[model samples]
Target: MAGIKALISLSFGGAVGLMFLMLGCALPVYDEYWPLFVLFFYVLSPIPYCVSRRVTDDTDATSNACKELAVFLTTGIVVSAFGLPVIFARVHVIAWGACALVVTGNIVIFATILGFFLVFGSSDDFSWQQW
Candidate 1:
């Protein structure tokens, strides 16, 4: 089914992104765990949106304050995820190569997250809530 296929691809993408994050932290040439802090950002990024979705009703209006605030918070979390690695690299806590790897991982992971919302954030038969 199309839903199954989308789930598989999204899972694969998330795995690949985590692999890159692990490499950035565990590679012998760049064995620094500072980049691991980005995992916190990853965990926090979706919370705002999920909370807002639960708290607000879907409306036909052009805009909604709760949803806008949720998006703002999500953007801050994502920016923090990207910025943390750069700060670590700048402070020499992690190598530039490691920062680059972490950034790439962030990109892939965020894209996968976005893809998930796009594919599942609908009032259709294939809603992710069923899982």
Candidate 2:
């Protein structure tokens, strides 16, 4: 089924994204684990939207304030994720190369997360909660 294929590809992309994140920590030239903190941003990015979906009514579907606020929060979370690496690099906690790697990983991971929402979310037919 298309869903199965989509799942496999998304999994592959996530794996590659994680591999990049690990490399930022594992590679010798810029060896440090502090950059891994971006994982928190990655994890927290979707929470607001999920909560907003539960709180707002879909039927009445006029411009909802809660959903907009959730989007604003999500944007802040994503920007923070991107900013974390730059901060680490600026503070000399991690090398620029490591920061670059982490940034790339963040992009890939975030894209995968978006893809997941597009495919498995926004549809009553497929619910990620079951997984």
Best-fitting candidate, scored by lDDT: 1
| Candidate 1: tens digits of C-alpha lDDT, residues 42-82 | 88988898888888886566799999999999999999999
TM-score of each: 0.96, 0.93
Each prediction's Cα lDDT score? 0.92, 0.91
Clashes of 2: 0
Return the clash pairs for model 1, or none. Answer: none
Candidate 2 residue spans exceeding 4 A from truth: 59-62, 129-131
The weakest ten consecutive residues by lDDT in model 2 span 122-131
Best model per TM-score: 1
lDDT of 1 at 3: 88
Q: What is candidate 2's lDDT per residue for 6-122, written digit by digit as tens?
A: 999999999999999999999988889998899999899999988987887674777889999999999999999999999999999999999999999999999999999888885
Query: Which pairs of residues clash in candidate 2, taking residues 3 or more apart in a chain or in different chains?
Result: none
C-alpha lDDT (0 to 100) for residue 94 of candidate 1: 95
